[model samples]
Target: MSRRVKNPTGMRVLITGASGTIGLALGRRLVEQGAHVVGLDVAPRGDEGFEVIACDLTDDDSVTTGVPRALDLLGGLDGLVNNAGIGGPAPAEAAPGAEVRRQLEINLLGTWRVSAACVDALVASRGRVVMVSSRMAVMQLPLAAAYGASKRAMVAYADALRLELGTHVGVTCVYPSATRSPIHDSTAAAGLSLEGMSTYEPLEGVVDAVERSLLSVRARRDVPTTRKGAVEFFVARHLPRVTDRIVLRTLADRARSGAFDGAALAEGVVARHAEEVSR
Candidate 1:
């Protein structure tokens, strides 16, 4: 029989990608709130005021071993946060390449590895699993098909997990809009930056949303970090064609402004937009 932690203060939580911008901030906040936090990252930094284990979520061996160590350190688990992910530009028209595979590996499979490993403990505690998905999961943008696909697939995984674990464990997916992070460095370096296409929200909102998902009495199915993010998620989920049109319009405008002029990865999209403008 599993017991629920009625008080937020002593809840034991494991957060992957604990060294990243959101992860660090989240870990700090949870510790401050009196929760016990254990972070897992490929590169562990002990200065984050929480115990961080060096775990590579993408590697099977690493996850299998590291998760148990974290569990041992925390004594038990109450929540698991799948927050590790990568980003790069992968155009839909182009053949799937390394970037696409890498995104799927980390964003989707990595989450799977961590979640699967934590299942037993979570079930034992009637704990919650919060997936740190992105707004891109619901709202697709041009020239970043890989990221969108991986994130969307993550949400699908979350849905399946919720159905399977709903009896004993709670599953929730948190969607955050673009925030200032190194995740976008690769895309920006490729000249396919999401600057004009998406608005940046404060990191605090995302942390708040994740906390809410973890601590809520009844877990929410889909939680967007900001009001704008909520609107985007609703529109994207309910009105697909509308979002497609909006994306196309945005792509065309960016193309006109030469945003994709020097971006080799965006050549296909830029040409398509140019053809549309010519018509």
Candidate 2:
């Protein structure tokens, strides 16, 4: 069985990607609830009403040193939120490139590194771990294969972690639908924006889900940030063929709409989608 911290007051928590949209909001909210929150980010800022640690999740030495420092600051940890991640556009048909490797490095391995570092401390406190995954982890979209694959792999890591730590530490994965954030700036710059394809949900919904997962009496194994996301996740997980067909249809629509017109990375998908639509 997983454990919960009934009271938020004085609960020690560590959050990664604390400088980003979701991480900043989550850290601030936890601090407002009287939790001792420490944030880890590549570029740490001190004005967020919580202590921020400078830790580059992509660097092993940074995480190795920074996580321990966070544990020390809190004296012990009651919760760890793997909220740090990155996104970029990479088509499935092309050979994986730098963007693909980067997405996997920071989104998947970075989470894994931080989670591994906190294992002993989390186990000691009988605490919980919350993975801030993406809706793409379940329902993949076209032209952003790297982001989907990375998040899906992160979900797998969460599942394995849950099984390994179920007796001593609770693990939960929270999937949030697209929200307005700089994380999408790169993809948008590549002219592969998800604007029409993905509906943006309130960031608060994701924050709430993460908080609930950490403090609930029983940790939820998989939590979608919204009702729509729950339905999407269900369809993708249980009716994969249905999900694939839906995605293909959407891709065809987007292709016909010229959504991928100028994106070099999306050329293949656009061509294939056009051919499929004609037939």
Candidate 3:
């Protein structure tokens, strides 16, 4: 049975990573629906047609002070979207432990900080929390271990939060498949490519999924965006060995192609032996 979500008209929502593609798109759509929206980002583009709260999720004082300031500005938050995150393609061996810690801080710990700060306000308003997790959280792929692990941890955290919060607040975890956005550019900048992951789903679809998650009264625990993502999620849950085989085979193919050496490329190694053979 399809669950219907309540319209968020006049509801106030605060979105982290509000300057990014997904965040901006979500803010715009919520605004169009008559919801009051506030965005938080370290380097937000000036004047996103809504209040942009300057926030650094990694900084303790910033999150502590900034979240309250945002609550003050918005009067109260009805929903909080933990949308800010970073991803790159680096083999686990190539990734430094420090770099992995940074990703954990920004992606997982940052979400925790914001949620802790906003819990009182959200509880007061009986609000909802939407987590922008990824398909990688469910179905893992090679060369992005940190990102996948962080997201998996996020999914677990959301489940725990939902159980803890009970009927006081709503929680929804969104799993979007690969979408065309600046995230890919950011990964490429880090010497990683997501080209073979999946075909880019429409960005609008992802935004719509977030909206639905926010509005749903009895929000489902998991929200997968694309059909393929739904299938993978199902397979990952039901047929673990099958999913493992598929992922391993895919990684094997990529490894054989020499296209998987993004960490080397990022370090300015122009011609790998694998690339030389492929060429």
CA lDDT, every prediction? 0.91, 0.91, 0.83
Per-residue lDDT over 79-158 for candidate 2, one digit per residue giving the tens place of the 0 to 100 score: 99999999888988889988999999999999999999999999999999999999999999988999999999999999
Measured by TM-score, how close is model 2 to the native structure? Answer: 0.96
TM-score of each: 0.96, 0.96, 0.90
User: Mind giving the per-residue lDDT tens digits that candidate 3 earns over 81-186?
Assistant: 9999987664565646766787788899999999999999999999999999998898887667788899999999999999988679989999998877766675
**Tens-digit lDDT string for candidate 1 (50-128):** 9999998779999999999999999999999999989998989899988999999999999999999999999999999
lDDT of 2: 0.91
Preferred candidate (TM-score higher): 1 or 3: 1
